[model samples]
Target: MTMLRDQGIILINKDSEISSAAVVAQVRRLLGMKRVGHCGTLDPFATGVLPVVFGRATAAVPYMSEYDKEYRCRIQLGSSTDTMDREGEIIKQAPENFDASKLEDPSYVEQLLNSFLGEIKQQAPLYSAVKVAGKPLYKYARQGKEVERPWRTVTVHSIKLLGIYHREGFELPCLDVLFSTSKGTYIRSLADSIGSKIGCYAHAAELERTACGPFTLDQTVKTADLFDCFEGLGRDSKAFLSASIDEGIVKATLTAFAGFPTQAVELSDAIKLTHGQEIKVFPDDITLDTVTFTYNNVLLAVAGVNRGLAKVKRVFTDSSAEFLREGSIDEDI
Candidate 1:
C-alpha cells in the first residue's frame, strides 16, 4: 500500500488506557509514515485531544506544543497516592473522623479553586515522563529511589468547578473541574495541590483534555473510527492521500502557525526563503516578532523579522529539506 508524503495534522480523540505516544504510533502505522510526531504528551491513563502530525507537518510540532490546553479533571479527595493519580499506590489517607463535608460547601470550594487561578509552582511528579539526569523520573520512582524533581511555573488561564461527585461509600468529595491553562500545566499536579490546600489527601481520578490550542475534542476522530476510515480508503493511494487532508480528520500544516502574522511573498522570494536566504521586508510589513511567509496560499516558511530582514526560523517548503533553527523562539508571541 503506497501513500503520499503529504504534510498534515490530525486530531485524535485518544481513548483512555493509551499513551499519547501510542496514539502517534498507531497513526504512523496506519498512514505508513516514518516522520510522525505528537504535539503534546498525555498521560497513558488520561484521554482526549492528541494532535498527531505526519510528513512535513512534523515540523509544526514544536510550535503547536506552545498552545494552551483545556481539560476536565476529577479530583478525588481524602486519599493521596504516590503518583498523584488513580493509577498510583495509596500513600496516605485522611483520618476517619476528618470533616469531609467541608469540601462539599460550594462557596468554600469556589474559594479554594480560585486561589489557584494564576501562576503557580508545580514539582514534577515522580511517576512522570519528566527526565532527570538523562533518565525519566518514573524509572527512579519504580526503583524506590527519590529524586528532587524540577519545579515549573505554569499558568492557569481559567478554572471552575463543573460539579461535585459523591460516591456512596466514599466519605470525602470528588470534584469535577473544568479548566483552561497554559501549556505544560499538569492537571494531575493541580488536583494534588487542590487536595493539599483542603488539608486532605487527593488524587486525579480522571482526566480528559477537551481542547488543545485550536483543536477540540469535537474535531477529533476516535481511534477506532480513524482506523476504520483508513481501512475504508482501500488501495487507491491518491484517495488515501486526499482523505488524509480532509477538513474533518486532518488539518493543513499552516493551522499550527495560526495567529502568527503572515506575509505573502512573491514566488521568487518564496523560492529564496526555501533556500534559507533572508528576504527584505518593509517596516510596515514587520509588526510581529515572527512571520509566516507564503505564496499562492501555501505556507513557505516561518521567519523572525529583524530590521526589515525576515530571517528564516523554520522552513516549510515543497522541497524535501525542511530546516529548523537552533534555540527556540517565543511561540506565544
Candidate 2:
C-alpha cells in the first residue's frame, strides 16, 4: 500500500490574529493531507511557537502539550478586562489616586512574581474553550449562563520581571515579564491575579509564547514561508524545518514523541511490536523511564519500561507492507 503524506512535526512562529485551529487547517490545505492537529492552543491575539502536527505526528500531541511552556507577557495595571485581556471591555479600574510607581518598583515586582513560582491554583478564563458537559465554557458564557469556574493546580516554574517600566500615556501602567509554566496555566489569569495582588485589577495587555516544549519561538519558521518550503519537501527527505523540510525535522522528530533516549530494536522485533508485545533489553543499560524504538534510525514506537521489558505504548506507523516489499523497510517514520 502506498503511504499518503509525510508524518512529522512542523514548528511555526505563529503570528497573532490567527487561531491555532486555523493554523492546522492551513497546513492541512497546503500539504494536501489530512490528520493534522496543533500541539496546544495559542489564543488568537497571542503569537509565538505553535507546533503543527501532520500525519503520524498527530499522535504526539498529548506528549507535546505536556512540555513546559515559556512566554513573555505585558500586563497593564489599573484596569481589568472582561476577557482578561485588552481585547475585552474594561470591567474594573484602579482608583484615580492609585500610584503607578508601585508597578515600577523592582523589589515589589520580584516579591509578587516570587509568590507565584511554585504550585498554585488558577481559574480558567470565563471566555476560554475549557469544556463543561462537552461544550466549551465560552458557549455558556455567551448564552448568559454562569458556570462554576473550576480551579486547577498549575506549576509556575519561574516568573521574572523583564523590566520595571510603564508607558507614559493615557493607557494604564504595564509590567513586562518572562515566565516558564507547566501545562494548563493561563497567563491571562495570572496577569489578572497579579493586578489583584497589586491592589488594582490588571489584564494581559500583550502575550507571546516563546517556547513550547523543546521548540522555541526564536528557532521557528514564519508561517508565511511554508507554502514553497513545504512543497519542496518529500516524505523521505529531511526538510521539516526549511521551507524545505530539513534534517532538523528528522532530528527533532526523533525526540518529538517521547522525548526519551532511544534504544535500537532488531528488525525481527517489528512483528512483535505489531502484535503489541514487549521486547527484551539489558536492564542495567536502560536508564530512562521510557524508550523510543527505532530500526535503522526509523522511529516506530515509544515503549514503557518495566524491569527488562520495553512494552510498546504508542505505534506511530505501519511499516509491515514496506518491510515485505523492500525485504527491509528502514525509512524514517
Clashing pairs for model 1 are none
- Badly placed stretches (over 4 Å) of model 1 are 1-5, 235-238, 284-287, 319-333
Consecutive 10-residue window with the lowest summed lDDT within model 2: 235-244
Query: Over the full model, what C-alpha lDDT does candidate 1 score relative to the true structure?
Result: 0.81
TM-score of 1: 0.90
Summarize candidate 1's per-residue lDDT along 100-119 as a digit string, tens digits.
Answer: 77777888998889999989
Runs in model 2 with CA error above 4 Å?
1-5, 228-243, 246-252, 284-289, 321-333
Backbone clashes, candidate 1: 0
Question: Pick by lDDT: which candidate is best?
Answer: 1
